[model samples]
Target chain A: MSLLAAGGLAVGYRRGRRAPLTLVADVDLSLAAGELVCLVGPNGAGKSTLLRTLAGLQRPLAGRVTLAGADLHAMDARERAQRLATVWTGPVEVGLMAARELVALGRHPHTGWSGRLRAADEAAIDAALAAVDAAELAWQPVDQLSDGQRQKINIARALAQEPQLLLLDEPAAWLDLARRAEIMALLQRLARQQGCAVLLSSHDLELALRHADRLWLMSGDGTLRAGAPEDLALGGALSTAFRSAGLHYDALEGKFVSLQPRSGGPTVALHGSGTAASWTRRALERGGYRVCEPGCERAARAAVKVLQQGWELRLGSSRRRCESLESLLSALAAAPVD
Target chain B: MIRAQWRWPGATLLPGRLHSDPLQRQRLRRALLQGGLLCLVLALFLLSLMLGSVNIPPDEVLRSLSRAGAGESAWERIVLLIRLPKALTALLAGAALGVSGLLMQTLFRNPLAGPYVLGISSGASLGVALVLLGAGGTLGVTLVAGLGLGGSLALAGAAMTGAALVLLLVLLVARAVGSNMTLLVLGVMLGFLTSALVSMLLYFSVPEQVQAYVNWSFGSFGTVSWRELRVMAPLLLAGLTLAALLAKPLDALLPGEQVAQGLGLNVRRARLQVMLATAVLAGTVTAFCGPVGFLGIAVPHLCRSLAGTSCHRTLLPACMLCGAALALVAALVAELPGSNLVLPLNAVMALLGAPVVIHVLLRRRNLRRVFAS
Candidate 1:
């Protein structure tokens, strides 16, 4: 059975006594144990509303959300918290509390009213710290730590809950490239080792594609397309979902191509096959040159040979060895176009 | 030379471990600090009892306190009748305001939030102002002469009602407002509205009534009698107990309300309980002590700095001990032992509290990160 399942789920907000405006509806989503899913979407695409609803933080406008085969909304807050934990993107004010103390608070559902951690609770906190590789940070004050270190503690706090399902809302939003990749890898490892389902909304589409086992792509028309990242890319679902003027998703490169191919531009015949050849092709294309293969019969303004040492530009029998791509572009500009 | 290491049997994670844990060491230090604060409170309590207009000796104060009715001497009356109740009132009221201030700060997640910031004290003052200034010509002059047990109860009851009403309004606004900052602004507006009503009442009232109101507004810990203490003590104790019991939720709230909810705390219910606790505490002290200032806003910041941790389990008790000590010191200073003149309680509190808060702010650069955001 799936760890979490939601069918016909609708989520949005209500204003006054008027009709509730549904941002997205008829959503069917499920997460199996040990699976990592990433929710990808544009702004105002109801990713937050959907994530909040699935986590039982907010009521779903339409249908049922079940966690481990039990109705999520029917359970008391503590019962639901014991099974599911959420990590948010917002910065937390931990005041003067130590990292271990903050992590121990995740035992709120298991402990008594005083939230005193027992022996079992202490072991869980230790395991959480170790899982996040943050044992060294356990004694440090949370406010004193850097943002990435604090985010590790935040994830550790959630892990201490010992939940079967974890939901994170753009947990890597504010982090830089290395830190963002670290968090994504950590979540993936947690799901694999602990056999808990991990689902997170992310604005970093490339990271999501690289790390997620499956992607839930939300379109502007309030539709969702879920499949393997490569499958979605190959099926053109990613491009269709994020369709905007002059924006295209390149499947081979696994990136969004926003620069359109220029029309009726100067032509260049590119030669050689290696990393240098591929990069030279890119630079030539970006420089508004129509780069042709080595054997194109079309009339060419300039012919370029990518040598082992440097780029050799032959403009009407005037050969010039360009040392760099910058110099090559500048040399190409200096060459006269007939 | 080998050093002998002390360890609790069956307590160490490893049987041969020699070093103690950092958390354990921190707990020990806080425990010692709290003990010191308790001693300070007791010493200040003694000082408050001993030093007044006509200075009474410690032995006389203790004798009067221990063995009641042993003698009807003037010293005994001064210690038993006047100073004892005044000191007890300061201790209880100060502790109450301190805990309430902590609750308000946590609930709103703002360092500037307190009973005064939320207009709770202003509500109490408006209630008292109505009784003393608006209806003074008919009712207050007589009530003022002998604010005996019954008349003081009436004032306390009125103050509680007014505070409850304002708290209800704030809670309603809290529900509608999107952020803590908005709720704080609305609370300040409510305070302004209540004070405006009070000023208008003062404008229309007789000069005698206006003087009565002004005297009440200066605030006094000495006005509470033995009878009033009987009423005030139970209410203040109950509020403090509630605040202590709420330490877990308040600590969870340090990260903000959404995370507190994620931790399985019933955020709405906890908020209601917190505001109710604040109302009971701030209301009771304002009733008998006449809107004592600075203690509510200052004591929590002082205790937070002294304790050096945001965990309210330690902070609540520390606030109670430190608040009682600070209030006793202020009360003693206001007494002006050698002189016949008594300084106003609020003036002494401002003189004492402002510097401690300023110093704490200057020393702790992370105060903004801890509370403002």
Candidate 2:
């Protein structure tokens, strides 16, 4: 079942005596239960605005946002909060609260007068902590936790709410490569385990592409496209929105390839595969040599053979067997230009 | 270290007893500490009553307190008219200033935020100045008692009105302003504006009127007679109660306003409520006791460090008790035993308060990050 569905949505701000400025217009998206969706865009691309709109943190300018079958804007904040939870990086004036206390705050909507925690609240908090792999951090102070640990705790806090939908704004924006992958994987597992739809915005496109169930590609033109990650990758939608100078989508690698194509340079034919050929092609491309396909599909002044035997460079009538790609490139450099 | 984790026992988590130790221990320790602090507050209350210039024998002071005699009885008059009210005034004023400071610091998320830092008292001063000087009189009423119950009541009322107006203006401006430094700077500027207006009033009024205003600005707890205490206590308690009620959202706020809002707290309403509580707490105290400095800014920080957590749940109550204790100590020191000379309350507070504020600023590595953003 769809937990949140936005149709004909528009989001932005209206300043004093000015017309409302839309950031994301006509955004149509639906998040089903247990789906992990990633929203990726450059700065000021309205990724946050879209997340805020979907989470009911901000009102849609012209569309209806239904959360758990109710109009998001029409519901009271507390009522909406019970069904939705959001996490983001901002200044937190954390007093002496432990990690558990932070997570317990997720139970705010369920808490009664004075916010006293009942048995169910405690059980939910504990289970949420366990879900996010943050159970061990329960007693530690929140401010003292590392960045990755903090993000995990943040997710646990949201999960503790037992909401039908979860929205996080860049939960892992400040971690190392390995940690980012871990956080992404954690979110993916959490969405499935808790059966709650999870949506997050992040600058790390690679991780999002690998782990997200769906992708919401927000562009600078205030438009967004939502589709399965593989479908977006296959349809060339990922590269279209992220394209910039010297950057193109590498269809083979499913990642953006930033290369300075050397125009009018003597080209060489790549005669191998695997890591050796790919790296050699990269090295040749970096040295201003265009590496053509093997069998010389196009005109080639040189053929660089990279095999288990060694790198064999045949430049016109002069053939040089070099020990490595470095020697081959150097040998190619010494070859007479046409 | 004082982050007391008192868990409500009725709630049991999965693997039920795994997390019970810290919660139960912290709760037990918190109870003991709070109880001990309560005892300390009472002891200081009694000490404040006993150690004054007259040095009335403790027994006589107790006797006079318990049973009143003739009109000419000096001990009875001293204990009843002077010490008891003064001590109570110190407790209420200190708690009020401390909690008010906590609210401002939490609301703005700035370490330097407080009633004094925000120029709240100066606004109160401006109010009193209007009543004393701008009222077109050679001599007029102030918060201190030169007149009867009616006069003191009128003075308090004027001061509260002035404070509320200034507080209203500050809260309105704070919503529009995002950065903590900008708000603090705005408060200082507002303080300056009120002070400037007050100076103009002083220039036009008689020296006797100016003198009354000056004494009022000097800051005093002893000036509040039993009658004025009646006016300040209920309001101070009410403000303190409001602060306690706000502790949860204030904790939610620790992660910042946006997160609090995400957690379902109405940030705008919560912010306004906090400001209202501060205005009432600071306004009433300033009206009754003048603008006592430093306690409002310093006490909250002091309590936070001692409690080892910023959770308003324990911190708010801790701040109140700690503030009461500090005020009593300050009151005792100002009394100057064995000498009839009483130190100016404002000067004493500044001397004590300035150090704490400076210490906190020095200790924080990211001063600019906390306020400038």
Candidate 3:
């Protein structure tokens, strides 16, 4: 079933007599149950704002968000809460509650006005904790946990709600590389196993590309592009979304690489393939020499050169002498004053 | 570790495992234990009524209780009239302050946020100062005392107004600065400003009026008349009931306002309701009991420590009961070594409450670890 549908959505914020900051513009998207989508965008690209609006945390300046054919705007807060759960970034202060107790708060909607946890509620909490591998930490205080562990507990808390849709704003912001992977894997598992429609905003483009079932690309110009990860990557959307000055995408390598400057120095031959040329090129640059055609002049008197897998040095009116890069550096430093 | 194993009746135990089922059972047991604590507090409240100045036997106390006018002696009249009202007022006032503190702390997402932290009590003090010191006469004194109660209530209204004003400021600042700590410091500064204004009013008052104000400031439950109780009781009950109704939303709020809104609570309305409830509670208690200190800030933390949970479902009631118990105990102690020499209830509460506040601060590191994200 289609869990959420946003039609002709537009969001903007007005700041004290200034022009409105337009975030999302005329976006249409539909998310189905058991689908995991990652929203990737640069800072201030409106990913967080879109997620908040979808979760009903923020009202859209103009848009219609419907869950299961019912307009979200028409639903009361409590009714909307029954279908959606969110895990927001930043510290949560709930006094001295234990992890399990915190997770049980997810059952607020299902529980009675008194908020008594039934046996079914207890089972759900246990299942959620166990699903997130946080069962052992249930009795531990939430404030005592590591950041990564706390993030997992928060996810577990959301899972305990058993909502149809889950929205997370930068859930992996504080996690290390390994923990980040673990959290992504956990989210994927939740989407598959629990049949939840999950949408999370993250800055980890590479990880999101690898793990997310679909990608929602929020551009700097207030537009959203949604498609499969491979489709986006192949279509150049990924590169375009993250483009900045001096950084170019390598389609074959699937990563960014810095363009190397040409070397300029005295005529010298170098014999090396990939590794040797790369290392020597780096060394020459560090020594303030640039690589160029052999006959090119304008090389400084102090410039060092490498040719045919060997270093060459030519002082004023002196013949070029071959030496290792280390010896060449030492020779330049130790040379007699002219 | 004391790994005490408590078995629920007719439940099968799985050997060599953590017994996940047992954990659920343990929670149920813990809830029952909290219930027992509440019952124990009720018993203590009854016991408090029996101990007093005159050597009226327990039987005579019970007899006086069973029949209203049968024991029309001065001793019975004093016990029924004076001490009972005072003790009950202390209980209600303390409970109100405790709930107010809990609500404020939860709403602001700060452990230190309370009636005093928000300057609500100080606002009440300012109102009392205007009544007692601003205008001076014996007739003015009677009028101020009457108006003082109403003025203190107005002070509470003013406090709510101040809180709303500050909330607007904080929200604007939060958008501009995007810093939580700065907003907290701003609240503290607002509170300081109100207190400074109250002190200025106190400085210009006449000595006799100052003495009366000072006595009220010391905090006592002995001043509530039956008539005042009639007004105070319903207000406290109604405010507390409203607060209790907010428990679920308030629990969502603890995670932060944004989270609460995402959970489908109108954060603005919830916050306003909480502020109004807290103002009514703290204001009414201060009006009747003369700005009693510490209970509004301390009891919530004490309940959290005892119950090991922050879910308002348990924390609200636990705080209410514990606050009443603490106040009742304090009242009993105030009346001890003979009821004639009553110590100010505020002094006793401070002696008890200050250490708990310091302890919460000292153990904040551990608390942060427990709730860290």
Better structure of 1 and 2 per lDDT: 1
Kindly list the per-residue Cα lDDT of model 3 for residues B217-301, writing each as its tens digit. 8877777767678877998999889998988878878877766666566776676677668877887787677778778878887
- For residues B126-175, what per-residue lDDT tens digits would candidate 2 score against the true structure? 88888888776633744334543566567777888888888888888978
Per-residue C-alpha lDDT of model 1 across residues B301-327, encoded as one tens digit per residue: 887777778899898999888788888
Q: Which stretches of candidate 2 lie over 4 Å from their true place?
A: A90-95, A244-246, A259-284, A292-338, B1-20, B68-73, B116-119, B141-152, B171-186, B204-208, B353-373
How far does residue B257 in candidate 1 sit from its true spot (Å)? 1.4
lDDT of each: 0.85, 0.80, 0.74
Q: State TM-scores per candidate.
A: 0.92, 0.87, 0.79
Candidate with the greatest DockQ versus the true structure: 1
- Please, what are the lDDT tens digits per residue for candidate 2 over residues A223-271? 8888988888889887787775346778788887775564777778888
Fnat per predicted structure, each in turn: 0.70, 0.59, 0.66
**Candidate with the greatest lDDT versus the true structure:** 1
Error of 3 at B280 (Å): 2.2
Tell me how candidate 1 scores on lDDT: 0.85
